[model samples]
Target: AQLFFISNGLSVGFASIQTLTDKSTGLKKGIKGDLTTLRPTIMTAVPLILDRIQNAIESTINKSRFARIFFAIFFSQKKFWSYYGLDTPLINLIFCRKFKAALGGRVKIIACGGAPLSPETHQFIRNCFDLKLLQGYGLTETSASATIMSLDDTSVGFVGQPLDGIQIKLIDWEEGNYKVTDKPNPRGEIVIGGHNVTNGYYKNETLTKESYKEENGVKWFLTGDIGEMFPNGSLKIIDRKKDIIKLSTGEYISLAKIEAELKKCPFIANVCVYGDSSKEYVIAFIIPNASHLKSLADKLSKSGLSFKELCNDSEITAGVLQSIRQIAKHSKLHKVEIPNKIKLCSEEWLPENNLVTSALKLRRKNIQDFYQKDIHLMYGNEHKP
Candidate 1:
C-alpha cells in the first residue's frame, strides 16, 4: 500500500510504535498522534491492529461514567440511522468528533484486510467513526488486488465483488462438503483467474504445478480459501482448505474459523485451536488479554499476581476456558467444535518466535510443536491410532 501511494506521486508516512502508542498506558491509541505532524486522510490496517484499537477505545469508554453514558446514547442512534443509509452529522459532531480527533481528525477512509474482521468490531468502528470500514480480500499471490468493499456498500461480512478484469470462480471441495451448488449461496473453494494472478511461485515447480493452472489461455490460481457467494455477488471468505481437520468421529472442523470465533471472547487475545485426527475433541492454546485477565483475577481475589502467575492460576485458567466455551456455544459451534480444554500462555506469539506470520496469522504447525507438552497433557494419554 505504501509503495502504491508513493508510485502515484502521493506522500506516504509510516506510523511507528512511538507515534501510535499512549505513553501512559502503553496501549495503541489508533492513529492518535500529533496531528500537525501527519494528519492522514486515508489509512489501511490489518484486522489485528484495528481490533486492538477497538479494544483501547472501548476500555477508555468503560473507565468513565460520563463517557459511557454519552457513548451509549449516541452509538445506538448512529447505528439506527446507519441502517437506513443515513448519516447522523449531528451525532458525529457531538459525540464522535472527539473520537475521530484521536484518529488524526481527518481520516475519511479506513481499509482493513489480511484477516477477517469480526462483525462486532466491524460495526463498532463504523458506528464510532461514521465511515465505512472497507473490508477487502486478497493474498500476496494476487498482488493484493482481488476484491474490495465499495464506498457505498452498507452491508457487513462480505468482501465486495472482484475488481475490474479480475475473474473469480468457486470449485467444489468434496471432503469439506462445500459445493458450488449449495443452497441460497454457493460455497466452495475460490479460484482467481485474471491478469492479477501470478504465473507461479519462484523456483518451486512442484508447488507451482499444484497451485496454478491454465484454461482457455487465462492463468488461474487456486486460492486455498473457501468462500461463500452472496446473492448480490459479493464473496465472504469462510474457511481455509488447509485449516480443515477431520476428527476420529468423521466430523470436519475448520480450525481457522474456530480460532476466529474464539478470539471474539474479551479474555482471549489470541488463540490456536488444535485437533488431532485420531481424537474426538479440540483444545486451544491461548494468549490471554492481560488487562481483562487482570480484571478477572481481581474478581477471583487473585489480584497482585504477576501476569505469568495469573496464567498458571487454576482459577484464572478455568475462568478463561469457561469464557471460551461460552463464546464457542454462542457462536453456534458444534459440541465437538468447542475446545475441550485450554492452556494460557503468558508470552505472545510473534513473527520473531515463528509462531505466527508477519500478518499475525497463526502458524499452526509451529504453534502445535511449540506447545506439544501442554497439548499432550490436555489430551490425557489418548494413544494415537
Candidate 2:
C-alpha cells in the first residue's frame, strides 16, 4: 500500500536526512517523509519505514497494542496511554489497492536497503501480507547500489550475492588471526571493487587511501562491515567493525548483535542497543511494532497482564517487557546485553525531525546529541525498565 524507509544510526548514503532537506521547505525540523501517493507494490526502502507502517497499523486496529508499542518506543517515564490513538482507517485505505489480475496482488514485492532489514520484519511482511519482500545490501561508496536479493534466491540470512560486475572478497587487516578471518564461513571485512566504487573522496586523499584499500593490484573499497560468506555463496553481515563496544571486562560486544536479537521479537520496530562496560550496562531505544504489539497485548491481557496495571509510573503491558527478555534468551544473548531500562520513544525519527538520513541511514551522533539529557538521566537513575 505504502512504503517507508529509514536509517538514523549509520551513514549509508552520506549526509544525514537533516542536512540534505530541500531549502525551500524552510523548516529546521528536517525531512518530513517520503510517502508516495501511488499505490506501491515493489516498495524498497531502509528499515525505518517498516517501523512506521507497524505503528500506524497498530494505532488504528488495536489501542492497547498501540499503547504497548509506543511504550517500548518512547521508553519514557510511564508515557504510554498519553500517546495519540490508532489509525486503522489509514491502513485499510492503504492496503485496499486496486489491481488487475495481471498484477497478482495489491503489492507484489517489497525491497529494503540502506541498512539491514530485521528478519522479523521481513518474515512478517511476507507471511502476514503475503507479499514477496526482498532485502538489498550496498552503500553510496558503491554508487549507492550493489548486491540485491531477488525472488529466485531470497535466503533467510544472506544479503544475496553481488550484482553484475561487482567483485567481492574478504580480506584480513590483521595477519595474526588470518586463519580466523580466512575461514570460508567466518567473519571478515566486506571489500567491493567495481565500476561503481568511487575513486576517492573530494580533497580527502587520506580517507581515500583508508577507504580504497588495495593488495597485489586488486583495488577494493572497504565497507567497514564484518560479514561471513556463506557456504552457499550467500553473504551474511556479522557486525560493524566500527560499532563494537568494549566492556571493561575486555569482552567486545557488537551493537548489531543486540539489535539483531531484539528485531527477532515480533513486536519490536526500531532497536538501537548501546553502552560500554565502562559502566558495564546496556540500554536500548525501542520503537515497538504497534500492530503486532496490540495482538500480543490482547493475548497477554487474557493472562492477566494489563498495560495499565503493569506499572504505576507508565502503562505498558508486562508482555512488552517479558517479550524482550524472552528474545534475549532465545537469541542466546548476554543477560547484561538485554536492555533492562528502556524508554518508549514513539515519535518515528524522521528526516524532518532531524533524526534520519536521506539514503535511509541513522545519524547516531545526531540522535545521541538530541537525547543526551534523557539518556544521561536514564543511566544515572537506578531504575531499570
Candidate 3:
C-alpha cells in the first residue's frame, strides 16, 4: 500500500536545503547541503512536490476513494497554485516525511520558493504536520532570497510583498528597445535594486551592464525571470527569459519550468527538456528517483496493474499527458508552456555522470549538450506514439 502520513514540518522545514547553494554565488553564501543547527526561521522549496502529486493521480489512483480525494486538490488551491505559475503546490509535502524528525522538533515557518507552492502542499502540511509553508521569490543576483511571505500573516503562494529597502520595476524590453524607462508591473524581466543584490558577475562587465540599469532612482539588477507586480505590492515569479524556447511550430515554450515540473515527479531525479522551433515537439530525458520508482512498482502491483505492461502501454503515455495537462491547468500556464514528450528511464542523472550538480540539481544545458543526439532521436519518428 502507498502509505501517507503527517510528519513534523520543521524536521525538514529547514533540514534539507540542498537547492539553496549556487556555484557562481560565491563560496561564503553558497550552501553545500542542508543546515543542521543554523535552522532558518523560513525555508524555501520548489514546485516539484506539487508536480509529483499531480502525476500520482494518473499513475496509481486505482479507482479507490483516494482517487477522488487526491484529484480534488487540483481545484482547491487555485489562487495558491497560480502563485508560482505551477498550481499544484499542495502536493509538494506528500512525500516530504523525513523532514518531520530533523527540525530539532521545532520550526517557525516553511517558505516554498523556486516555483509556486500548491495550495494542497501548503494547507496540507499546515494542518497535518503543523508546519506553515509560505511561498516567496528571489534570484541569485539578489543573493538567493529577496522577498518572503510574512509568517505571522501569510496566504498560500502569495510570495507576499518585497523586503525592506529592496526595489523592483518593469521595463520595455522587447528586442528593439534597449534604452527604455520603467513601467509599474508589466510582464517583462523582473528588475531588482538593493544592497543584497550582487554587484556584477565576476569579470563579466558587459553581461553585467546589459543586466544592470538605473531605474526609479536606484541601480537595478535584471533577473531574466518574467513576473508581475500586484496592485497590493506583492511579487510573483512566472517564468524565465532564458527559458523562452521557440518550438518548431513557432510556439514559444518554457522548457526550464517544464523540466522543473518533471523533476518534481517523485520518480524523477534528473530531467532535461529539449526542443527548438526546428523541432515538432519538445522531448525530455528523465532519471527516476529510485525510491519513487520502487514505490511505482509497488503501487502498480497492489492495484493489479502490470508495471512492465503499463510501462510500454500507450495508455501509460496518454496518462503522462493527462497528468501534465492537469498540472498545466492547475498552474494556469499558457498552451505553449506545456511539454508533450518525455523519455523515462530507471537510471539516475548522477553527479558522476555530469548530469547533476554535486548538490544533485539537474544541469539542463549540460545534459542537452552531452545527449544532444539522443534527445533528437527521442523526438524523432521511430518512437511509438
Candidate 4:
C-alpha cells in the first residue's frame, strides 16, 4: 500500500504495507520532519492528526503578525473563489512552497479515518495541500473500510456511499429517538451486511448474538454508529449509539456532537463533554491551546500567569469558557446543549497516558474517574441526582 499510516501501530494490519513511520511521538513530525525520508505519496491518518497538522501550519504563519493578517485576508476571499479552483495559484506561491519542502512535494492523497472530521478542518487541509483527502468509514467488526469517499470527492463531513460489496442500511434507534423520518435528511443506526462483515465472534456468543441480526439470509452487523443519509447518497456519521446519554430531564444528548462543536473554538486544543442520568446539565473538561491561550493572556496583560496558572485564573477561565460558548452559538446549539460547567486542564490527552485511545479518541470513563473530585464539586457534593 505505499501509505504513510499514523496510528498506535497495534490495531489494523498495516505494518506490512510500504509506509513512512514517524520516529518521534506525534503527527507534528508530519509537518516538521523531512518527507524526503520516505517520499510518501499517500497518507492515512485520523482526523485528530489532520487537525494537529492544520494547527501547526496556522501557528507557523501566525508567528509573523504581517503573515497572519495576510493569510486572514487571503483565505477570507479564497473561501469564495475556491469553488472555481482560483485559490490554488496564490496558495501555492505563498504557502505551498514551504509545506511542500517538508513533505518532499509528493503527497497526492491523504486518507482520514477513525474519527469525525469537521468540514471546516477538512477544507482547510484541502486548500493547503491542494490534494484529495479521502475519508473512510468502518468499524473493527466490518474488517476495515465499509465505505470510502471517492478520490474526486472534496466535500467534507460525508463519508460517501458504501463499498461495492458492502450493503448498508439504517434502522431507528428508540433510545436515541433518532429516525429516518425527522428532517432535511434521514438518520438512524447504520447496519452493515456483506461478505466482508464478520459472521460472529469466535467464542463470545452473547455479544455475537446481540450485535448481529439476520435479514433476508444476510447477517447484518449492528454498527452502533448513528448516521445521516443525504440526498446525494452520501453518509454522514452523527454520533455513536453508546455516546448518547439521557439527562435527568429526559433529554437525549450526544456527547460526541457537543465535543465536536466545542473543539471548533481556536482556543480549545481538546475537550470532552460529559453528562448522565444523574446530572441535570452537561459539563466539559477542556485542554486549552497553549499558544492561543498565551496570546490571549498577552493581549489581556495577564501573560505572567503562564499556561498552567492561567487555567486557574478566574478571568482567563471565564474568557476560555466564553470562547466555547461563542463557538457553540455559532454552531446553533441550544441553551441546554451548552455546557453548564467547565474545568480546564493543562495536560493534553495522549495514548501513552491512556487518556486517549490509539485512534486518539478520549477515554471518557477514565477521564471522568480521574476528575471525580472536580465533577463532584461542579454538581454540589450533596446533589447526587
Best lDDT goes to which candidate? 1
TM-score for model 4? 0.86
Worst 10 residues of 1 by lDDT: 17-26
lDDT of 2 by residue, 1-385 (tens): 1112334332122222223222212234543322222334455556665644444444454557765564344322212221232223333333323211112244567677777666655643443344556777887788866677767554555588788988887777452232234654666788898777877789998999889976676667998887777776678776787777776666667777787678766667676765746667777776666556546655545435433333222436356667789988988998777876766566666667776676556667677777676677768864232
Q: How much is the lDDT of residue 25 in candidate 2?
A: 25
| lDDT, residue 226, model 3 | 69
Q: What's the true lDDT of residue 206 in model 4?
A: 100
- Tens digits of per-residue lDDT, candidate 4, 107-168, equal 77888888899998888877666677888899888887589899767577888889998999
lDDT for position 365 in model 1: 87
**lDDT of predicted model 2:** 0.60
User: TM-score for model 1?
Assistant: 0.93
Every candidate's CA RMSD: 2.6, 11.5, 10.0, 4.7
TM-score to true structure, per model: 0.93, 0.67, 0.64, 0.86
Cα error, candidate 4, residue 272 (Å): 0.6
Tell me, by TM-score, which candidate is best: 1
- True-vs-predicted CA distance for residue 377, candidate 2, Å: 2.4
Would you give me the overall lDDT of model 1?
0.85
Answer with 1 or 4, whichever has the higher lDDT: 1
Q: lDDT-based ranking, best first? A: 1, 4, 2, 3
